[model samples]
Target: MNEERIIELEIRQAYQEDLLQALNSVVAEQQKQIGKLEETCKLLHDKLKSLARAEPSPGLADERPPHY
Candidate 1:
């Protein structure tokens, strides 16, 4: 009975190790994706900033229709 119990424990440990490795891989992949998304957001933010600086800010609310 003791030998059987040891074998069972070993099997469980192996499965646990495999699961842990799979989880680690998934976490690593997610981290990489997060980094890419952050970089993309930064780039878009910079582009928007540049565009805002280049555009003229005309007040549309103060203008009346040409027909009036």
Candidate 2:
């Protein structure tokens, strides 16, 4: 009965270790994806700024000067 209990405990420990490893891997992947998304957003923001600098946007009818 003691030997059986030891084996069962070992199996549970191994299972828990495997689960922790899998969770770590998932978190790492999510972090990499977030980093990539941030980079893409920054690039897009830069592109928008460049475009705005290159040309004026159209809707300026009710205009106010800097003094206003």
| Candidate with best TM-score | 1
What are the per-residue Cα lDDT tens digits for candidate 1 across 29-53?
A: 9999999999999999999999889
Poorest 10 consecutive residues by lDDT, candidate 2? 57-66
Checking candidate 2 for backbone clashes, the offending pairs are none
Local lDDT at 21 for model 1:
100
Candidate 2 per-residue lDDT, tens place, 1-68, comes to 99999999999999999999999999999999999999999999999999999997866776766797
Score candidate 2 by lDDT: 0.96
Model number with the top lDDT: 1
Counting clashing residue pairs in each candidate, in order, gives: 0, 0
lDDT of each: 0.96, 0.96
Assess candidate 2 and give its TM-score to the true structure.
0.71
